[model samples]
Target: MRTMLVADDDPHIRSLLRQVLTGEGYQVLEAADGLEARERLEAAPVDLAILDVMMPGLDGLELCRIIRDTYDIPIILLTARQQLSDKEQGFLQGTDDYVTKPFEPEELLFRIKALFRRYDVPSLDKIRIGRVLIDRRNYEITAGDETLLLPVKEFELLAQLAQYPGRLFSRSELIERVWGLDYEGDDRTVDVHIKRLRQRFAEHDGSFRIRTIRGIGYKLEAGNA
Candidate 1:
């Protein structure tokens, strides 16, 4: 069974998430704040985390940075702030997805399911495409002697493309598989992440490329095949 940790200062939010996740067949762990959540994470591994932005100490952003630095677990941030800058910051800080405070529970559940379906435990250890090595367990990507630290979305998008080399995926399809079908963002986000991934690969003298299908979308080229 997959385990999920819910960290929120609001008792109401914690209870609601627990009820919904439990019904969806997930083992739920609850924490009232960032400090408590950190302790829980240290004691046991969780497949995903639902973090609230406003907390007594550490804060969701800080906690997320710590989690990203320490573990490869997926994170979905919950915040009342609806600013684009806030969302971008969360994504840049290694959050896999973001949910606004007045969110639909079903949307959150859908995102969780989407993430699990794509990057479950069985595929979490390592993913290799030609000479490019993605250590999903450690969140490290290596091409020959150079290792690259990818942001969360970049890693997820690359992993999805790697799963089926040479298979094209439209922007909508990539958004559905990687950012969740219910994600409320523009398709431009996918393009931005792909651009970043290509830059990282180039820095390491790696030619493992994501092919653009012009009006369609993208595909991972078989660099060694």
Candidate 2:
């Protein structure tokens, strides 16, 4: 059976979600706050999580980041705030969907079904190599407690290599896939970005390193992180 985790500080809301989801033939997991949710999340195979934005400890956004950095699971935020900025922040933190509070149970159920159709939720979003997490979805590189944000092109370049660890990509292919034809610089530009990316990861003490394939391109290799 498909599993869904419902996390909220309020018992009534949790009960409501459990009732709604359970009736729809989903096995429901319950957590009172983000911390408890994380504990439960780490212990089980949860298909999806519905999280309240405000919670004791971690909070929903922080929990969402951790989940995105390590798991393939899809997330939906349950919040009272309807502001566009708040929703945008949730998305940047790696949440896939959002439903404001006081929403109809049936509508929420429909949204969950739609997300399942859109995303291959079982497919991993972030690639973990030892202590470092290469998060392609959010353009985030996280190692332990530290998280680094990279420029779009640099992030895409890193993500491209991460998608197929140890696979070689020629400089031309990297430019075409990451920089695109719109890029005005020569192949040296790829080397320049690679150097900068390496330096940035070094500063963050990442466990993985990008290895040059001599005359070919580059690949991600995990050393003593």
Candidate 3:
């Protein structure tokens, strides 16, 4: 079953969303605040997210931006603020849909289904460039007949660079985008992961190459993607 997350500080709202979403055959993950929601996001792949706008910790708009930056999941914002400006800001942050407070459960369900209909692309999980293949859903990499499982951090870093091939991501931008800004470690952590990735790809005789841009970070150069 596909997973859905509801990040709302109110117990009643969370319970209501969970019960209804579970009844519709989705596995619902609940978070009382934005931090927990982000933890859950890092831990697994969620198909969709329903976020309450006025939560403690990181508010929904910010959370939406973070999710958009890292994950491919669709997001729907739950808010009591009905102002046009508020809705515009939410959209500017990359939310797919918005549901104001005191919303009908059926309406939310309909929106969720509509998103599935729109973005449920079959190839969203897989990336192939020449002899290399990365499956984001299964966390598996295929090089010819040999298949390898990559650690979560390494896999995410590779996927991020591969998705935006030729884009030069700075070290700081990569750290904040791939590993979250809360990471206290120095920017060299990205260098470590990149070194590990390069070693692994060499062992597998991968076709695509991740090239370092001197002072800039890295970019993926696929020969015949």
Candidate 4:
């Protein structure tokens, strides 16, 4: 049975999440705070984590950073603060999604399912094409002697393309895979990210190219011999 760890100080929130996730056929593990959550995580591995941002000790943001740095588990940060900066902080800390408090249970469930689907898909943690080396877990991409820290979305998109060199992905497909299938956004989002990635590669002597097929999508060129 797949396990999910819920870390929140609120009794009602924990109970509600436990009930909902249990009904969805997940083995639910509950923690009262970030400290307890860490203990639970260390005791055993879980497939995913749902963390509250305002815990008494360690807090959700700090916990998310610890989990991300130590493990590859997907995390959803729950916060009462709905500011864009809050969401950006969670993303920078390696959270897969940010859920505001007072959110619909169904929405949370949907996000969890989306994360599961993505996690089950095959991915490459370390991909090397020519001089560029991508460590997806560390969120670092290196070309030649220069190492760059990529924004969350850029790293994920690049990793997806690097996973299958020379394979084409439609803009819609890339958006679905990297940004979640339920993401409601313009295809221009993909284009903008690709543009940024190209700039990063160019800074390192243009070691590799991400090919754009007109009206199609994008592909990472195979490494030259």
Clashes of each: 0, 0, 0, 0
- What's the lDDT for residue 187 in model 4? 90
In model 1, which runs have C-alpha deviations exceeding 4 angstroms? Answer: 121-225
- Off by more than 4 A, model 4: 125-225
Kindly report which residue pairs in candidate 3 clash with one another: none
* 10 residues in a row with least lDDT, candidate 3: 161-170
Report the candidate with higher TM-score, 1 versus 3.
Answer: 3
lDDT at 127, model 2: 84
Report every candidate's CA lDDT.
0.83, 0.82, 0.85, 0.85
Residue 126's lDDT within candidate 3 is 88
- C-alpha lDDT of residue 2 in model 3: 72
Please identify model 3 stretches exceeding 4 Å from their true place. Answer: 122-200, 203-225
Top TM-score model: 3
Model 2 Cα lDDT, one tens digit per residue, 25-118 = 9999999989999987755557789999999987999998888875566799999999999999999999999999899999999999998887
Residue 187 of model 2 has an lDDT of 89
Residue 82, candidate 4: how far off, in angstroms? 1.0
Q: After superposition, how far is residue 86 of candidate 2 from its true place, in Å?
A: 0.9
Candidates' TM-scores?
Answer: 0.55, 0.56, 0.60, 0.56
